[model samples]
Target: MNNKLISIALTGLLASTSISSAFGTNISIVGRIQAEYSGINIEGFSSQTTVNDPTFFSSWGIRAFEDLGNGFRVVTMIDFGFNTNGGSIGNREVFVGISKDSLGTLKFGRTHSPFADFAGGWTIDPFVYTTLQATGSGGTMIASANGLGSGSYSAVNSVVRFTSTTFNGFSFAVLLMPGDADKLEAHLGGHLGGHGNNIGDTGGENGEWDVQFAAKYVMDFQSHKLEVFGGYSRDNVSSAQKKITAFNLKTEEVGRIGGVWSYKNFSLQGQYDFISKALGAATCSDAAALGAIGDVSTRQCNTAMNPGGDGSIWYAGGQYRLGNATLIAQGGMTDANKTDVFASRKSKSFTVGGLYHMSKRTNLFGGYQHVDVIDKNSIVDRDRNTWTVGMRHLF
Candidate 1:
């Protein structure tokens, strides 16, 4: 089936390579794959050198567009991913949507949340969220791609994605994933991530629900670009709602704001996030029952405990093309989430690397990184240094 799609897409590409007409359709296949070895070390864990793709599984996808005249078009894409080391299919991305000169762009079927855009704009990006970079293995600064612990419990599966056409250097985008009582939210990389749902949120009978809303704006200048992003997500349960007995659950809410800047060969990005903890009578059950079933249970109005927290990250990076080689350097620090306890979480990472273009379709790259992590109580003060070399090919 994948081969057939690629074959048809290629045939389409060959049939309509020109685009001077107002009405036409074209298809293309695009993707990249890489291989590398990772030397990992944790606070007290054993160090190991493992070979695999650090950023993500190798994947490919087909993208097609059809011009419908009157400044409008239809766009569709689907990607299949597979692990390089294990050679097994992983996750996937699928979308089909339309765009217009005035209506903007909208697509459905499991897509990246608008917040995912914030993942790549500055130097820390592309790699900061990569599991191969400095503290990449720790998922330290990387929020859950599936919307698990994002913004306290904010964000929804952008199963429905929308992007506004650019106007005078400004553009906007949003995502919506509505569910029963519990809402779900997702973001980043156009991946099929996550959306939070309250337990037993079936229908609206219990008076419980969840919602996630996100938006982003990009400002383009003559020499650079700036993008602003913000989002909010929440889960609420009414006092009348109960699990096994009767009671109420604390409401959950999270908010985020930040942006990215790029000019010439330099780029910078940063963001701040806060989540309010789920606190209240907790459960309607007695202390013993609560103890037996846990502080959070399924009685009259019991819900999962929400540990609201705060996280901030920033990074600066640049590339200089010196003939066939592009020199790269990046340094950044993440103020870890510590909304509840002493919350003394912090991390710093520095890296230097180079990518040598072998041709239009391939590149050779190598780099080294230094990273440190400090937590509250300083229980685990793990530090690591990595040296890696790899190659990537685009097709």
Candidate 2:
């Protein structure tokens, strides 16, 4: 069939089907578009600014389901991402799965891990996925991307995922990804290379498994609510017999604890993470912004420069809603590995912002962030200030 004919057929099917019918198909189109005017100033460097969509924010997708007999349903999704500023379109999340009311939901495909989705993730951050988010930009969490052995991006690939039904305010989730065979090529760049492979050597992978596990609990009262969560994620990369790089990159591990409390018009949330062998995004960004490319070879944000050491990250924020607007304040710090290789990789950042509700599916948001990074080893101590004002619309 021609492309236009196929689209017409699908649209007709969607319009004719009864979404609530037990034996009929239900389909949904979902997405969001966001744009912002952003500016950044780095200490001792020229300022840069742009009017565009920030990273990982603009996307669109389709979700559909067919109800089967005996409480079973077939579900599927295909999502893609794009930059409003300038960049090639890319895949976001895609999956096929089955769900049952009493049993739970199980899926196989590429998507976010349990750690970054359910257990204790961006939910705690009011401005998640925005320029002021605490994960990749604020030094409050490990910025794991989808690589050969990585599993902590906003979405991951080749995953087997399961989430249990909530029972008495408790729920859990798990994700497993099998590693690929070693190409036998030397990886000298680092983790998350240009081709999304290992740029630097750290041995190679051979049928190893990466996993994530998480759980959450909730308590609700008439005007108050509370949610507590915890999770752990691991990226394995130590199966090959040959090790050929100096970056000493090993398996990455992260443990997180966090919760959110809401009472009437005020809400508070926070999270803390213990990270091993995974570089902090804030530290890496600071290095790159200061023109210290040598500090971060090949644009690998999660490279383990000091494989034997560990660090911690913590963030806290609160917001108050008044009529049509909400005010926000948040900040956090990342303490890098204590080894001499990263003795000065510590960073502290804070953000202040507000959101104005234009309607149920649209809002106006703006925020300012201040970040300071210390790198005694390279004598590159720098400070950065960023501000953004944007509007987001959902459909």
- Let me know the TM-score candidate 1 reaches against the reference structure: 0.65
Q: Write the per-residue lDDT of candidate 2 for residues 20-82, one digit (tens) a residue.
A: 446476877677677878776777667767777654467777778898889999988787777
Estimate, for each residue in 74-189, the C-alpha lDDT of model 1 and write its tens digit: 88876665547766444345678898978688887655444443223222233332333422232223343233222111123335667776676555665554444343211111
Instruction: State TM-scores per candidate.
Output: 0.65, 0.82
lDDT of 2 at 390: 85
Candidate 1, superposed: residue stretches over 4 Å from native: 1-27, 101-103, 118-141, 147-158, 180-263, 266-306, 336-343
Q: Which pairs in model 2 have colliding backbones?
A: 187-200, 187-201, 188-199, 188-200, 189-199, 189-200, 190-199, 190-200
- For residue 273, model 2's alpha carbon misses the true position, in angstroms, by 0.8
Q: All models: lDDT?
A: 0.45, 0.61
lDDT score, candidate 1? 0.45
Q: How big is the positional error of residue 127 in model 1, measured in Å on the Cα after superposition?
A: 2.9
